[model samples]
Target: MSQEQHYTFGVSTRAAERLRSLAAVFAPSTEQLLGSLGKVEAGALDLGCGPGYTTELLQAQLSPAWTLGVDSSEHMLELARARCGPKLDFALHDVSRLPFPAPPAELVYARFLVTHLREPVQLLRAWSTLMQPAGRLVLEETAFMRSEHPAFQHYYAYLAQLQAHYGQNMLVGATLGTLCEAAGQHVLDAGVRVREIPAAQMAALHAANLPTWSQDPYARAAFDAAQLRQLGETLREIAAGAALAPAVSVGMGYVIATARPPALVQG
Candidate 1:
């Protein structure tokens, strides 16, 4: 996918590395999601596997005979290759298209990938076909996120608008369970987890994301250059703990949904 198409975030070297760091926050939930998939065999697939951070976690948890991380960004694949072992290989392909040019995987995990699709349900059905019979599909996404910081809140409001323009959903995590059911997958488990990060970490997370979000031409068209620059400056201030912004921590809600392909009915 072109950078313009992925307006929410880009795949620059910096962005991919930052994404790796952000992935750490959800490591615990990711581990649980993998465990919920029960005994794993064959292989696993990490769709939209940025820098292979999640892939690394998968290797440690499931230790599948083969693991593949697929992403459209060659730059991200470079970093993923550096981090992953021979067992975990990466492929360069756009996820929006269907029919992955690889073997069917028994375990498929995708985090924060569906929100980008205009028709996530269609993508879900395609993903089901990629799964082996009774294979598991685990997904993590955000239901809602809010911050007390003025600059942060202001920036997010515009960011949401920009995502809408590109037909993306900033809060698609809320409906993941229903979407999974619609795809004919049996819901195994589903729940929400909330994270409250201190201003310092919040600053770090946004420091990486804000630049990617603001630098997009779509974002630029939505807000003036001065507005983005000010938000950037405020983010730095928050990271440095110099700003007198509200002491409230950044609150985020993540919904982790797990489902399995339905077994065929017997005669």
Candidate 2:
């Protein structure tokens, strides 16, 4: 996936190393939604629902109740709908113009969606029309606060060098609090929770996410084969070194924006 297609070859070389050891140590937004729903559940809207991994997880947890995974990528939607089938719906819909059967949703959640978007607030506001009053709007983003890991320094430095050429916002590691607040909720609930994905699983994420990042129609223009190879070599070095942290603290924060009928933030 090239940069033009809104994808990155790898998320963060340094973070991936730490996350693998501490997968369970972090908070998952899906877990948060299950907590908020208690017993009663209605519908779920997953923005940027790629490959339907999270959507399928939600399906496993929330049964009988239907969930819709929406994305602009027709290919992604096809794969998602194929993976989950009609029991769990999938649509090739843009966040800006959500084309759901219903107007508002009981839960409108986007994981790793806002980061990719240049103006995610507009998309959030659009979801407001689709969310019922007091409904939940969850935006889970990975915050790149700072890595204290001694080994991560070199790997992070390399990633920064690569991103300077590929794209500045490749990882979408930015201010989640500001965006959540801008997309105002009567009660803005946001918190940072770190998680890890084991080396094996980290490898899987790379397997799954690398293709998307490389094939991006626009973004890849800046990507150099030699640079990517260098990054790959450096990441492998970091991944192989040491006993590894029990849990790498990656900024896997959950920023929740509850919907209001009248809406809080003015256009």
Candidate 3:
């Protein structure tokens, strides 16, 4: 999947609109929990916002609190803008090198973005600086257990490998709390939610197989015939199998790591 084809994964635009309600699956509960801690400051940054799904919600849920969505792919950014209704700002930016004017922000948010990141510590260091006193950096990420299917073990084994090959960041234990404390931020609170993404839906996503979804745009990015065959076999097993226990969906919430300057923490 080339960086350009990044838009092809997951739900359709119409589905995204309908399931826009589902998008709140993670943060709404999270913000409420964090709210009991304290109120978020005026403005927030939606880091690695992808298609602006969460960005749109951040605007409504955290109303009166402004948000900015940043993503690396121009295509994803465009789709995000289209889904969005002009309340929040969107920008094309690489997470490794965030492009915020002024200094940091009052609140920083990210969902399912950092796990695909290699230098997550670098990201924490950068975003932490974006905060003023008591400001927070929130993040969420997804993980899957590949050994869930005994019958289709080989199939999912290959699919998981393919996902990794395509440059997906594997942050096995880098949840917001773990990373925040490591990065010297005060860990306010963190939690995890386990849910089902539906094996049928997973099969559908594998079949749609967007070009951007594979990162195939960046020169010689086609999967080998063997790989595709294995993926097909994997999806087939998933569709046919009984009691596939691979956690269908899980979101780790690091929604409210109070931001304090490194200098302040040092003293």
Candidate 4:
């Protein structure tokens, strides 16, 4: 990871729980992406694996002989190790650095990680080097997200600014397939996934996600703490009210990209 850019959502119990909740929400789509890949010859790695949720899903979906979850946060890794078994292991490393010493993985999977990097394409190129010939790289990222509530919209706008401030791309998912191609990977499947969460679920989702944002300096800088607190209260109130519930929906757009490293050229 670049010293200048940091993922503002620092590791915390609340953040960890929020990640696990998100993993659960996106599990089906992730499973679908993995299922589409068929089988693999070697190990699978979950890059930026938080709480090992996706790692577990990868094991279940692909049944790769070896599964490793890599994250920079030891706290998140602890949560992951607790949830996973011996078949699934955790590694502490900066994903951008790709410092782990191991054999090339047959599958490299990442969820919501690319947007945090300054040079996601370059990182993709580096990750491609960690793959065996024809190894698949699966990436999941948010293409776009919107909520029916104005407060949510207001929050996302600032979130986008914060990501920009950190030299990250909030909409990087939109161009991942092309980036994969630019990185000398062969794009096999690239598609968008649209999911609408009911008002209750949406409210719950934000409620879980808010804690990390609330405590984040970038979030506070983007929107004052008082406003974020009010938004939280509003989300709770919305969740509690039946009449207000069904009228609201949270729309999320995800891009799932699967690509393979170009076959090694024989000398």
Candidate 1 Cα deviation (angstroms), residue 3 = 14
By lDDT: ranked, best first: 4, 1, 3, 2
lDDT, candidate 4, 220-246, per-residue tens: 666777877887887777766633644
**Number of the top candidate by lDDT?**
4
Model 1 TM-score (2 dp): 0.88
- Report the CA-based lDDT of candidate 1 relative to the real structure: 0.73
Which parts of model 1 have CA positions greater than 4 angstroms off? Answer: 1-7, 244-267
- Expressed as tens digits, the lDDT of each residue in 107-128 for candidate 2 is 7777666655545565566666
If scored against the real structure, what TM-score would every candidate get? 0.88, 0.69, 0.70, 0.88
State the lDDT of candidate 3 residue by residue for 169-210, as single tens digits.
444333667777677777766766555555644553443442
Model 3 Cα shift for residue 186 (angstroms): 1.6
Relative to the unseen true structure, what is the Cα RMSD of model 3? 5.5
Which ranking of candidates, highest TM-score first? 1, 4, 3, 2
Error of 4 at 48 (Å): 0.6
